[model samples]
Each structure stands twice: as C-alpha cells, then as structure tokens.
Target: MMAGEKNPASCYLDERTFRLCCRLFLQHSETIQDGWSWEQIKGTDEGFMKKTVLIPVQSSVMHKQHGCFMQAENMDHLTDDIQSNVEDETAGVQAVCEIHAVLRYEYHVLYSCSYQIPVLYFRASTLDGNPLSLEEVWSNVHPNYRQRLQQGPWDTLTQQVMCVTS
Candidate 1:
C-alpha cells in the first residue's frame, strides 16, 4: 500500500449510486435555482468527491406570523364584508428581519476494497458556518427518507456531523 491510499478491506462508494443520490437530492429540494448545485472535483486515491454549494433562504410573513386569524361578530353580515383589501406587504418586515439563512449538502464517494460496496459520506451546513444538527437535518428531509436516514449507520468526522449510508 502507498501513502494516502485506502486499504483494500475498506468499504467505499460506487459512481452510479453517487449520481443517483445527487439527482434525488435535487428532486427533493425543489429549490435548485436557489441553490443545491453540485460540482465534481478531482478524484483521490480513495475515490471521488462531490461538493454542493450553499443557498440562502429568507423568512416569509407566513413563516413568522404563522397565519391570520380574524373574528367576525356576525357570520351572515361578515361574509360579504370580509372582502376587504388586506395586503401582507412584507417588504418592511423582511428589511429588518435577521432570519436569513443558507443550506448546503456535500457528498464524498469512496470504493471499499474489501466490502467492494460504495460508501457515501455527506454533510450539510448553513451559510453562517454553523453545522446542522441531525434533528434539524432530519426535519427537512422528506418523510419517506427520514426513516432510512435515521436507521442508517453513519460515520461522523471531527467538527462535521455527517450521515453515511451504504
């Protein structure tokens, strides 16, 4: 074995699975234009690395205030009068709000010489430089995938709480 080289017994990731995972991520996020773009970097002795860029997300009126709750004195008379012009007009609110945030997901795929299966390692973070907690990440994931994500045996590297699934 050479320096920086992976052991033959180590389990690594495959190329096809990596590509499929990338496509699935985009499909679920639905905000690809806003971010979630990926780039393939040079391959290392172990395998390949894919980096996903960070994207920002701002809070909306609905998110802040939840929803409007109106009480009418008369059900019959209020029905006709409820058609008043009510503009949410979040321009001013958005200007002063500090709830702006960004999201990014990265993938590292390696080929395991022993197991001979592809191993995928991924990490997600915010633009503020704060790494996301497992719960926070889990909440954003689609329900169908949440169960699998939680059950999967993931290896977390130092400073990065990544989830690795075979």
Candidate 2:
C-alpha cells in the first residue's frame, strides 16, 4: 500500500464508526446517505490491502456558481444571432459549473482522506435533516453525465436495498 492508503481491515473496522457518524448526523442534521463502495483494484499487487469509499455532497451547488460573470447584452434586435450567442454563453457557464463541482468534490475527498480516517464522509447540513436524491446531489453535472449516473450500475443496487437502513 501507499504511505497514506487505508488497509482493508481498517475499512471493515471503520464501518461501525462510519455508521455511528451517519446515525449521529441523521439525528442532528440533514445528512445525505449516498456513497460508493469498491474493493481495491490492485490490492494484492501492492503490499497492504486498500479500499475506497466516496460520499456525495450537495455543497457543489455553491461551487457551481463561482466566477460566473454575466456579460450585459443589448436589448435591441434579439435576432437568431443574439439568441445563439446567449445560448453559447449559457453553455459555457454550465461547463464551468460542472468542472467546478467535480474539482470541488475531488478536493474535498482528498482533504478528508488526509486525516487518515478509514471511512471518509462529507457533511453538508446543520439541521434540515432532509434526504438528498442522487439527481439532486448531482444536479450540477452535465446532462450526459447525469444521465449516465442515473442509469449506472449503482442505481440497481440502490433500488434493490432502498428499504435497508445503514
């Protein structure tokens, strides 16, 4: 394993710790319970076993709006040219939002991983206690990316275990 990678055993042990954290958050805050679980793709090849857990966040909503300066357009003659230009600008803004969201999510994961915690999770609320759907959490993503996730393999597992609590 790398110097900072978590061992597989730690992942199993930390499951309870993570669950407790989730329960605490659920009790006190609007914690979203969505995560990715996967075995290390190259564990045996490396010295120690490693595993990864990824938690989604709604915090991306803020990151999605940064540095978005809208240019003022003329009010006269709103022809096809003007409409096309406006659409192009909006598309660029959407692209920027998507990139910002993905980068922010990655940075958060890296920062959380630096703590040497076997289970890394993201907390986004203080009290609302509202559950977030995957579509809502990933709302900033591009249509194609969102569509792919909506139809991804995890969707099947989520549906199958919708009623099972953490």
Best by lDDT: 1
Q: Give the TM-scores of the predictions, in the order they appear.
A: 0.39, 0.21
Residues 83-130, candidate 2, lDDT per residue (tens digit)?
334323343434433322211221121112334454333332211223
Candidate models: Cα lDDT each: 0.46, 0.35
TM-score, candidate 1, is: 0.39
Indicate the worst ten consecutive residues by lDDT in candidate 2.
Answer: 102-111
- C-alpha lDDT (0 to 100) for residue 77 of candidate 2: 27
